[model samples]
Target: MRITTVETFVLSERQLLVRLGTDEGLAGWGDATLEHRPGTVAAAIRELSGYLIGEDPLPVTAHWQRLTRGGFYRGGPVLGSAVAGLDQALWDLRGKWFRAPIHQLLGGPCRDRVRLYTHAGGPPGQTAAPERARAVVESGYTLVKASIAGPVGFLDSAATIARFVEDLEALRQAIGAGADFGIDLHGRVSVRHARRLADAAAHTRPAFFEEPLRPEHSRLIGQLAASTSVPIATGERLFCREEFVPVLEGGVAIVQPDPAHAGGITEVFRIATLAESYDAQLAPHCPLGPVALAACVQLDLAVPNFYAQEHVIDLSSAGSSDLAILRDPETLVARSGYLDRPTGPGLGIEVDEDAVRAAHRPDLLVPAGNPSWNYPDGGFAEW
Candidate 1:
C-alpha cells in the first residue's frame, strides 16, 4: 500500500510523537521524545516526514539514511532521536504488511523466551527502597539490579562510599548468593572517586557496574575498567553507532542502548552488532514506557550478545501515566529474570492512545535534582 499521511502528537511537553498512516488504514506509532524537548523532536520528525510520506514505508534503511544524511550536518540527540521514531513506525508498518512479528522480519527468534532483570534493592527499607528489592526476590527473580548509592559527585567523603557499601552488602546478603546483583553508579562520580568506589564494590562481586562515570568522561572509563575487576557498562547517552565506537574499542563489558532514543530497532540492531564485535554484552537501557520496552524486546530477541534487560516492572507507584494506554498492561512479567518474547504483530505491545492523551503534559519535564538528596546543596546526586 502507498503512504497516506504523517502526523505528530505532543500531548504534553515530555512526549514526542510520530505516526504514519497508510492507504490500507495501517498506522505505526513511535516515540522520540527527549526530557523537555518533545516539541523539538516533533518538529524534526515533521520535517523528515516530508521525505517519507510519498515513499514506500517499508524502505526503512533508505528513509533512515535520507533523514540522517539528507542534511549536510547530522547526528545528535535531536536528529538521531527524530529518525528513531520514524524508523520504529516504518518497522511497525512493515511488520503489519508481512503479518509477522518484528523479530521474524529481522531473522527470526534465537531463543524460546527473552530474559529480563529487576531494578529493586536499594537501601534497607520497609518502604519503597529495600522493601521493593525484597519483594522482587520473593516474587522469584534471581537476577536483580539495584542502585547501590544515591547521588555522589566529585571527591566525596569516603564515609559515603562506606555507607554505600554497607547498604549494598546488606542487599547482597539479604538476597543471598541465589541472586546476581548489578550495581548502577549513574555516572555522577569522577575517575578518582570511581576508582575507589569500584575497588570497594569489587569485593562484593557485583554482576557489573553501570555508568560509573558520565558519558563524556567515557575515555577514562576504560582506565577504570582496567584498574578493577568490576565489569564496566555504559551506552544510554549515546544516540548512534559512531558515538559507540570509542567505548567498544576501549573495552566495555556491556553496552546499554535505548531503542526509543537510539534510532529505534534499526540503529540498536547495529549497535548490538558493533558491541558483539568487541565481545560486549547488550543490556538495553529502558526506563521509559512499554512501546519502548516492546521495541527493545524485539531487538534483544534478535541479538545473540544480550545479557539482560533493565525493566521498570513496578511503575504503578510512579503513576506510569503512559502505561495506562499499553496494549498489554501485563507486558512486563519477569518470572526467572527474563521477559518473554511478545506475540503481537509489529512491536507487539500496543500503545494506549487514550492513556497517551491523558498523560500529555503541555510543559516538558526538566532534570530535577537527585530524588535521594533533599539536602540544601542537593544530595550526592545521580540520574
Candidate 2:
C-alpha cells in the first residue's frame, strides 16, 4: 500500500505520536518522543515525511536507509528519532499487510515470554528507596531498577559515596537475594566516581550499572568496566549502531538501546544483532508511551541474546494516564515481571486514535525544557 499521509500529534509535554496512513485504508502508529524536545522531533518527522508520502510502505529496510542517510547531515537525536518513528510505522504496516506480528516477520520468536524491569526510587537521599523496591518485588517483579537519586557532584565528599552505597545496599536487602535490581547513574557521575561506586557496591551484585558515565566518556568505559565487577550497560543516549561500536568494544555487558531514540525496531534489531556478536545482552531502554514499549517487546521476542526490557513506572501517587492512548493497556503490562509474547499484528498493541487526539496538549507544541539543577556552590549539575 502507498503511504498517503504522515501525521504527528503532540499528546503531552513528554509524548509525541506519529501516524502513517496508506491509500489502502490502513494506518499504523508509532512513538517519536524525544522527551522534552517533542516539538523539535515533530518538525523532524514532518521534514522526513517528504520522502515517505506516496512511497510503498512494504520496503521497510530500504525506506529506513534512505530516510536515515538521504540527508547528508544525518545521525543525530532528531533525525534518528524521526526515522525511528516512521520506521516503526512501516514495520507495523508490514505486519498488518502480512497478518503477523512484527516479531514473526523478523524470523519468529526466540522465546515465549519477555522479562521486564521497571524503575523505582524516591527522591535523592530519601530512605524510601528500599521500600519502593520491596513494593515492586512483592508485586511479583523479579527485576527492579532505581536511579542514584539527586545530583552528584564531580568529586563529592566521602559521605556522598557512602550514602550511594548505603542506598544500594538497602535496596538489595529489601529485595533479598532472589530478585535482581539495576542502578541507573543517569550519566551523572564522573569516570572516577563511577569506578569508586562500582567498587563499593560490587557486593550487592546489581544486575547492571546503567550509564555510569555520559556518552562522551564511552571510550573510557572499558577502563571502568575492567576495574569493577558490576556489568556496565549504556546506549540510551547513543542513537545508532556506529555510536555503539566503542561501547561494545569497551566491554559493556549489556546494551540498552532505546527503540524510540535509536532508530526504532529496524535499527534496534540490527543493534541487538551487533551486540550479540560481542556476547552482550539486549535490554531496550523504553520510558515513553505504549507504542514504544510495544515496539521494544517485539524486538525482545526475536533477539536471542535479549536479557530484559526496561519499562517505566510512574512513581507519583496519582499514577500515569499515558496508557489511555492505547485501546488495550493490558497488552503492554507484565505478569510477574514477564510480558507474554503478543499475537496481535504489527506492534501488538492497538492505538486509540480518539484518545490520542483528545490528549493532545497544544502548550506542549512549544518546548519548555526539562528541569535544571545546580550544585550547592551554584555550579551546574546534570539532571
Q: What is the lDDT of residue 380 in candidate 2?
A: 90
Q: Residue by residue across 8-87, what tens digits does model 2's lDDT show?
A: 99976657889999999889888888988888999899999999999999999999989999988898788888988999
lDDT of 1: 0.75
Taking the tens digit of each residue's C-alpha lDDT, what string does model 1 give over 144-259? 77764545657768788777777677777767777777887777778898889878867778888888878888777778878888888899888889989888877889999887
TM-score of each: 0.89, 0.96
lDDT (Cα, 0-100) at 121 in candidate 1: 48
For model 1 the local lDDT of residue 76 reads 77
Question: In terms of TM-score, how similar is model 2 to the real structure?
Answer: 0.96
lDDT of each: 0.75, 0.87
> Distance (Å) between predicted and true CA of 191, model 1?
1.3
